[model samples]
Target: MPDLSSFPRHSWLRALRQGLSSIESQSLGYTSPKGLPDARTAVSDYLRRTRGVLADPQRVVLCSGATQAIALLAHVLRNRSVAMEDPGFWLHRMVFRHHGIEPLPIPVDDDGLDVTALANTTASTVLTTPAHQSPTGIVLSPARRTALLEWARAGNLVIEDDYDAEYRYDRAPVGALHALAPDRVIYLGSVSKTLAPGLRLGWMVLPPDLVRPVVSAKSLADTGSSVMDQLAFAALLRSGDYDRHLRLMRRRYLARRNYLLHALREYLPDATVLGAAAGVHLTVRLPDDCDIEDIVRRAASRRVRIDPLSWCYTEPDCAPPGLILGYANLTESQIDTGVRAIAAAVGHSSQVVPDINGKVAPDSGP
Candidate 1:
């Protein structure tokens, strides 16, 4: 979830009001299943200008969210093995499995997804978060980017989930992988991080060849997304309010991230923080001897909610002991308190907390 407190409530209200007022009486009926054309145009322009994605409105397929977008892809590309990052978004794996498309877990490292290892997989369709990998904030290296593109050109499809690419703090913004090989890459993104996940608004900038199939799949899934909602979002994008909201959020999130980093340095001096330069969450690698479940339990007892990094892994046993701490929803003081609680939890673990879907053991407490 994004920071709801920072949402541009007034701007969204203004845009939505204008959108509703501008809806012509004659255009009240159902529109194209591809979603509002104006919305697509707005998104295309925004993506190109900000993320360097080369998209045309004709190729943008609007869906409920990235989840629905991937579901549509699974439906259209059924029976195909979709290679996803091993310790990737677990929800994606479940979505693919539910849709009857088994996802092949590909290993990811400091350089993002191991393109060399991915090349060895029989799966031709690969889903990757190349910009800022989920759970692990590793950006794909330039050389590996080239190799991935080449591989995609060799009759493979790269599904680029450009999620939360707008929140980089320390370095220059990394361009979307779709910009490199638009023809072979399917770019998917949503306003879930920027605006709100409740909106369920997202898009897929598809290859020219995949547009029709995806559009048809979208049509079958739902007649179309809410026309009024699309119109309001289009207004938000065209009026530049969405970009403004991003700017405000970037500053706020950066502060929270810095405070969290400083707190970690002070409280958990032994822990290693990963992916702190970007994204809303940071992964903290704990000492191997520490029981993650026990620590999580202790933190929970102190009213500090921390997610176990092991939950994202397909092979949790093989993954390093760590916690995925999201600072986006917490205040600076809260983050400090949370880190202190976690540090205490780490320091006092005397028994192994049994993994209950990455939850702390019921008996374990502060």
Candidate 2:
């Protein structure tokens, strides 16, 4: 067998290393079910300055991770119906199901979720990733944002999954929809995409009505995340180290993104790269003739893993023949090698690579 150890590790390890070196101590005790008070306070300030959302520290509930936050929120809203993006984060839907609330489908275009389609869906809660819609890599349109806020005026709740929210590189950054309407939106963010998913650390800005129940739910779920990790994160945020580390990661991931774009052009023809700005991964859609599953199997055979976009959808029809390549983990050279392997295995080109480099906004192509 060939040596398969040459592959690069995912971004999680790198984040863990950063977290360890920056804040290396383990307090190892159980934290508050409502999360670290100081951490919540700091998060409130951070959101105010970063995303323009004015949040109450007391209203913030910290938990194990974003997924846990979602689960807890679903539990709290069990009586209410749920609405989610059609090609939304599948795991989010799974959590809703586990809690006995099935999210209604909301299809999306390049401009993010279809707010118009949401008219008839009866729900007091709607989950969405607005900063950068997953899979499609599109920002939510301003009109849709307005409409969503309008929907919220009717007492609808928006679970804002700000996953990969800080990684923007292309157009001007999109302000948090939560900021536009805090009471109507429940904001969820974590170190999963930013620092490390393993930390199992995340926070949620709950609606006033749901705060107590959600906190109780969290307490019942796991009591809380690690005290030391939460404290360390608080210290890191206070010390500005988290921002510094994010700056470093931005520079690093941007370079990797460029390399991937180049690979698309050189190694594959009739291919388009999308979702480059502000996230760890980008999706590349191949032409119709390409066998996506075959390409995936081929790439895996070469000892590299690439996620197919179709896996994210709940609907029967897949969007396109594509793969979601997580560039944040791989170095530039590894990206070149991996893309080359994928291209060669998929009957594309081994010799050519894209001289073009960039993140495609919504409407360009999937």
State which candidate has the highest lDDT: 1
Q: Give the range where candidate 2 is weakest over 10 consecutive residues by summed lDDT.
A: 1-10
lDDT of candidate 2 at residue 241, scale 0 to 100: 68
The global C-alpha lDDT for each of the candidates, from Candidate 1 onward, is: 0.86, 0.76
Candidate 1 lDDT over 1-366, as tens digits, reads: 679877788988888898889777655577778887788898999999999999999999899999999899999889677889989988888899899877888898888889999899899999999888997898989888999999999999999998779999999999998888899999999988988888899999999989999988888888789887788899998998888888989999999999998888777767899998899999899888988888899899989888888888888877889999999989987887788778768766844332312233443553
Per-residue lDDT tens digits of candidate 2, residues 110-168? Answer: 77888878867776678899988877688898889999899988878888998688888
Model 1's lDDT to the true fold?
0.86
My TM-score estimates for the predictions, one after another, are: 0.94, 0.86
Query: Model 1 segments beyond 4 Å from truth?
Result: 350-366
Off by over 4 Å in 2: 1-31, 348-366
TM-score of 1: 0.94
